[model samples]
Target: MPAQALATLNPETEEQDRRASVINELEEDESVDEVEHSTQRGAPNTGTTPANAAAQPDIGILPSGQTQPSAPDTPVAANVDLNDVVTAPESELLAMQLDTLPMPRPAQPLALLGSEVLPGTSARLAWSPGIQIPGLSQPTPVLAVNGIHAGPTLCLTGAVHGDELNGIEIVRRTIYDLNAEELSGRVIGVPIVNLPGFQQGSRYLPDRRDLNRHFPGSPDGSLADRIAHSLFENVIRHCDMLVDIHTGSLKRTNLPQLRADMNNPDVATFTQGFDRMAVVHSSGSPGMLRSAAVAAGIVAVTLEAGESHRIQEHQIEAGVNSLTSLMEKQGMTSRMFVWGDPEPVYYDSDWIRAQHGGILFSEVDLGAHVSEGEILGYVADPITNAQYPIRANSNGRVIGMAVDQVVMAGFAAYHIGTEAEIPAE
Candidate 1:
């Protein structure tokens, strides 16, 4: 064979082939989610599932034997110090949500976490002076920030889904040739929150925990929760602001946008500043890192960049520019951060899903404008090739689109950001 033909035949020689394999691995991992989903659907007691049904309270476990002690034995306290209640034992605090949070022991080589860590200032709480996750050959991620000048604590975390590496790219690039002295506060970038999942290219950790859902996590929950708790407690607790970075995982693409809870009185103000924002209205899901920040009263927002687990230059550029703009917005940096092309299309949006299981064929690109009744996409039977048109029920901009041509019944095929529009010239 000719030299050109031989080169083409060599899988190890092509960088694109490696990337393609990585993408395939991500896709396969998502397939595992489908299996678990199928298990839930097929379970005989699906009604008992908390996901499928409203959770019932354990009324039976209430204090049944307790006598009526409404008033304390010593009914004297008119002016007792409230500090008694304010500064309770960690044991008591831990018991309140005993079953939920991380229960991690201090690393055996507790010294593994550096001995004297400089917890950053209030504004840059997430930027710990220095620490380490022991056992890992890598000099833990904490030390990555050492010697960096104090600045606003801007946390740009990515790949919480493991496969979504777009945000990682943003964080990696922002730090390249960065000058701490030039920054006013701090930038705490956990480019990959779910390191194990990222390594496996899976969404959840090995223990099946969704790190995103476990918020304000306990120091004693699952591994993911523990890590999250450690992260929040040791990192974000001090920051005045946080920006979580993410990409559309599971074969979907989201237009570069901000997903924040417009309903949050504290958070709504900043995330909404951008021109193209997709307000998720999610203050905090139980395990989500962002929600934990929200509860902690930190100004936090999650930015959706692009497709999952891959480095798209435009996406990275968009993310970097957005982060810089956000930093400047908060008066952290002097860098000129440009707003995205097209004034941000603001919206309170929801998903339009497939009603019947079929293959999803999209008619529009993410970020494309659409009218009511427009053919946003079509769901077709794979074997029969019979098409079921998925139309837009309301006028909106497409914030997300399914990357997979195949989808199932009730699968979210498209997400429309309503009340958004291209800026007028």
Candidate 2:
């Protein structure tokens, strides 16, 4: 999608304010992650805020919670930093920010994808939409871990865009690091939903359709729709909650944050479970998986991490920590995850675009707080050596930004999460 085509450029607005497009952060093209971004600001909110199974042997776990031959593997990065990225809030504050929702008590076994995942066991199942893809028709890998006790079924979906590697890593780390014996309900993970896209390193399906935009799809529709329908029916329906993970797209990067619909009470409560994670209110696009899931009476949110294509260890670690904290809050796991400082909930956001095409140089980093009219970066024309500064239109933090690279005029240069407000103490 062209950068110029994204912003709803207002002709009446003056030049100073017109430099930044005041779009509802959630409105985005199919090429980018559907969840929009903004600058970050405001006080921390404590209260606010903001699945499934299958089975097989050899690729399955015993009741003793031992790993099988096909257990999900961790990312193969030797120097990856596994430390907690965000600092913990004060002890008193942590105590006040308790789990707002009661723990679910699901005692029955998890039945999914034509197989039963018994309690205290894990399994790697094969899932397919039954669509023929020539040499790439193999069923996608699905990881399921059913806990011994009772709780909610949490589903984690990654690589919805295929090229977003950070989400895949986050899912893998969260699922495989689980101890079924110590868990309450269940965890279902699909690290790669768009298998063809992942294989080809493309963001779209073989039909060039954005798979993320087709959700709760129809079997009679296009290929993307069929696959979406299959996954939604066979996997998503089984989820008590869904975390559709993603990363920045179109040569952009995002701060690790939760894009949720704060209007939904259940979703708002769910957003509070993550520790030290920024929460951005994005009602979501019509066909988006997150919006579709919520419409189907399931609490869902999109976890936007780092950029696509490359796997950044810090982003992966931050995502994993947030998930662990969420599970711990939900009573699904006994892991002693530390709760971090409360991040503000952003109700609005804006995109600061470049006014001139040139080599972009960022003056601020991701998550940097900025006042309105502050210089975010500059675009320097190589031909005439003219430099144009990009300034913020709102007081907020830099939640997303394009990396230092050549960019065309009107490109989204900085996304600020504005109008930050916290839940009452």
**TM per prediction:** 0.64, 0.74
lDDT tens readout by residue for model 2, 339-385: 77889898898888898899999999999999988999999999999
RMSD of 2: 30.9
Kindly report which residue stretches of model 2 are placed more than 4 angstroms away from their true locations once superposed: 1-106, 133-136, 422-425
Give candidate 1's whole-model lDDT. Answer: 0.64
Clashes of 1: 29
Candidate 1 residues 1-425, lDDT tens each?
23443344345446356445545644665566664454332336544544321121111112354333332433555887766756467777787788787542221111113343232221112222222345532322542332224444556677777888888888877755355445555555666767677878888876887778776666666676666776777666756788788888678888887777666656766764554345554445655777778777788888888887677888777777666667677766666655654354464577898987877777888789999999987887878878888899888888887885667888888888776432221
In terms of TM-score, the best-performing candidate is: 2
Quote the positional error of residue 32 for candidate 1 in Å: 78
Candidate 1: Cα lDDT at 122: 18
- As a whole number from 0 to 100, the lDDT of residue 121 in candidate 2 is 89
Q: Give the Cα-based TM-score of candidate 1 against the true structure.
A: 0.64
lDDT of 2 at 365: 99
